[model samples]
Target: MQIPIINRSRHPLPAYQTEHAAGLDVHANLAEPVTLKPLQRALIPTGLFMAIPVGYEMQVRPRSGLAYKHGISIVNSPGTIDADYRGELKVLLVNLSETDFVVQDGERIAQLVVARHETIAWEPAEELSETARGAGGYGSTGMQ
Candidate 1:
């Protein structure tokens, strides 16, 4: 699937590192490094604009290495970029570690995954169909 993108920053366009990678790596477009103290959050920009297709969205996700090694992660987890949005791609990053971390210009701060989505039509009813494990979630099932 080919998507149209505008690169306004000095860095190259984001791309998938591996052939089978689901998400493409996105970078920061800051002129200088931004420091995030403990428990701090910031909206980092990518300096790139995209024309996402209808019925699909761009999901901004966290990098596993940053989360595991530095306790840095995206606050919204999978941030959504709707199809109609025509703005720079920004990431909401948070520092979960005790120490501060510096984000450099053109740094791979997050990953963008393109996914197809659907709109639902609600069929209101008095009562819903029953199931054995209805409404059970968040570890409701036994752990092995």
Candidate 2:
């Protein structure tokens, strides 16, 4: 699916690196490097604006390499960008390691995954149906 986007930054538009990649890698748009000390978080801009189609959303997610190698993660993992938002795309990144992490311009900081979503209407109900594992969560199931 083709999307209409406006890129104000010098970096190229976000794209899928592999043939079957589900998300497009988004870059950091900054004039200078931003440093994040341990347990610190910052909102990094992407300088990208998009007219996301209705009934769809853009999900901002962390890169596995960064999370595994540098303990980098998004403060709001899988952040949702609604279709009506017409603003710059920014990523909220956090340093989960013991040291500082520097965010350089044009670096792939997060990914943008376009996903189809549904609009739910609340229905007032007196009672709900039961299930086999009703109200069972948070390690209620045994681990292998």
Instruction: Give the best candidate by TM-score.
Output: 2
lDDT of 2 by residue, 13-91 (tens): 9989999999899999999999999999999999999988999999999999999999999999999999999999999
Residues forming the 10-long window of minimal summed lDDT in candidate 1? 135-144
Q: Which stretches of candidate 1 lie over 4 Å from their true place?
A: none
Error of 2 at 16 (Å): 0.7
- Candidate 1 — which pairs collide? none
Candidate 1: what lDDT? 0.93
Candidate 2 Cα misplacement greater than 4 A, ranges? none
Kindly state the number of residue pairs that clash in model 2: 0
What TM-score fits each model? 0.95, 0.96
TM-score: model 2 vs. ground truth: 0.96
Model 1, residue 43: displacement in angstroms?
0.5
